[model samples]
Target: MKELHKTSFWESLMIQKRVIGALLMREIITRYGRNNIGFLWLFVEPLLMTLLMVLMWKFFRADQVSDLNIVAFAVTGYPMMMMWRNASGRAIGSISANISLLYHRNVRVLDTIFARMLLEIAGATIAQIVLMGVLIAIRWIEMPADVFYMLLAWLLMAVFAVGLGLVICAVSVKFEFFGKLWGTLSFVMMPISGTFFFVHSLPQQVQEYALKIPMVHGTEMFRAGYFGSSAVTYENPWYLILCNLVLLLFGLAMVSKFSKGVEPQ
Candidate 1:
């Protein structure tokens, strides 16, 4: 029993590490290929999107929310939300899209899911740091007052995203329509998830409803760290952590069941 346990432990640690490293390298190269700016699009794309959103919002809602700079406000929540959205959306189709690779017994479904999720998370994190650096350089945003909270928030958000992605990956494997539903739901989540604005700014009833989604709670914690006291009200940090743990367990259970029961058509 001890020997089996030790073998399992080593395999889980060493094999998963090897799998993640190889997959991550593949993702980075495939995303950029042999180019001068290889892998830079990971940051460039989000920064440009943030810039566009800021310009559009400024043109329309400039006077309505002048006190909170829209760019700074966006910098707080948008990238985090996009990280979840992009990771979950792609994860949902990961199995189907890579069915060929999974047919090889060595490439487990969980490994693929982890690889995809990590790729998206790493790309998004890099983009966020670069954008924040630019904002700081231009004096549009200040250094985080609580860098620890910012780090913690990002860690929680990654956990939250991976949990959500696991659920989506399992469902999409069994029901292809799940991919479409994921896309639709991501749009629905955008306005209500507090990705572009602070939660307290919303009406009380709206805030209560938004808090029902764990992602909103995750984003609130992230924004709190980035904007500090200026972020308005946030659910307790422990509450967010507890919710992420529950979601992760649920996602793992779902994926395990799916792997056991479902085979590709």
Candidate 2:
């Protein structure tokens, strides 16, 4: 009989790191293949979509807004929203896509889910950075006022996205209806997500309702950082942090509950 030896926590962590790294590479290759620019599409795709939105806003809302910088507004808001959107959206298929890999001892359902969400988050982050740099170089948008605030908001948003993805993944795994309806449901969530509107713009009565949304805090926090004293923003970092914690805890519990029951099939 062979006796089992347990690895130290550090050792176990390293092993999981290696496993996740391999999964990330596998995902990139599987999604993009070895064709032209392959993984580069990760960022390029978001950049293009964001560019299109920026152009559309420039074309349509030219005279509609005299106070705000429409170009900067679109540039900052859309990509951040897309990060969470893509992260949560891609999480649905992760378990099924890598179902075969689950037979391995090192691979986990959470690992597969994390890998996919991390990829989307990385792509959106890179696209946001690159687009901002280019736009600033061309004088299309000014540099952010508070870089620390901007960075913090991005970090919070990323975590929020992962939490949401975990919950969405768990729900989709448990119920077929959620998996099928997530696409439509996500669209309905977009407008209210603080993507296009500001907390200040909404009426006093509705502002409280808007603040109830964690996504709004993230968006508002990000814009506050970029727009600085020029714009009036109501962002409570503590509230967003609280929401993230609750969501993350609930999501982890749900995923763990469902994953144990998920055999190879």
Candidate 3:
């Protein structure tokens, strides 16, 4: 009996893996289409946005928040912000968008959310790497001080984005108005997200309040890794992890409960 149960568990896991893979492929095709530049848009979209921001800052000769490279600063910060926005934005109303897929016995609400999240995260990560490489090759920015820590910070930021995405997805499904409200509210989050500036650049009290936002901690930590000792970060990795965990758990519970209540269209 025990052996049979274990075998069934592994088989179930494999099925889910395949299902998610299929869903990912389908999502890409649906969003990007079959043209030559179709899939390229995944990375290109974010890359162009980052490039525009970098050029804008460069043209303006924006005063450095720190002594960090302005190009590198924009490269790191904008893509990370896009990861959060893209993931959550795509996740919102994902179920309704892919409602037909729900007819399949193997498909689940979480699977749709995961597929979208994976696509957004993958695109953002690829854009960041390509942008950084180009900048370095052109001598526009120095190599990151700690490659491992830089990657770790990026990973943590991705996790937070995914958690927040899941929550947004579930909530939007429950309340239709949430989708529009969140779209407008996300813009408000940008200035405070530690994207355009560092937390330490703010006044002491404001810095304390800013660190409470998980994305700020992730951004500051990412800069700290990239710029080495010169970077000033008020990050608590543990706190960010805890917040992700709570959001993830709550999101999963909500999705599981509310998904069953969704009426087929």
What is candidate 3's lDDT per residue for 38-143, written digit by digit as tens? 9888899988998899889877877454466787788778889999988988898778888888888899888989999999999999999999999899998899
* Selected candidate, larger TM-score, 1 vs 3: 3
Give the residue spans of candidate 2 off by over 4 A.
1-7, 61-64
> Candidate 2 lDDT, tens digit per residue, 1-265?
1233344666788999999999999999999888999999989999999999998988897638758889989887999999998899999989999999999999999999999999999999999999999999999888999989999999999999999999998988888789879888888988998989889999999999999999999999999999999999999999999999998999999999998987775
Predicted model with the maximum lDDT: 2
Candidate 3 worst ten-residue window by lDDT: 62-71
Local error of candidate 1 at 132, Å? Answer: 0.4
Itemize residue pairs with steric clashes in candidate 2: none
Q: Please report how far candidate 3 places residue 218 from its true position, in Å.
A: 0.3
lDDT, candidate 3, at 53: 93
Taking every candidate in turn, the Cα RMSD to the unseen true structure, in Å, is: 2.7, 2.9, 1.4
TM-score of 2: 0.95
User: Deviation in angstroms for 156 in model 1?
Assistant: 0.9
Native-to-model Cα distance after best TM-score fit, residue 137 in candidate 2, in Å: 0.2
* lDDT digits (tens) for residues 99-172 of candidate 1: 56665556677777888898888878888888888778988667776777778888888988898889878777
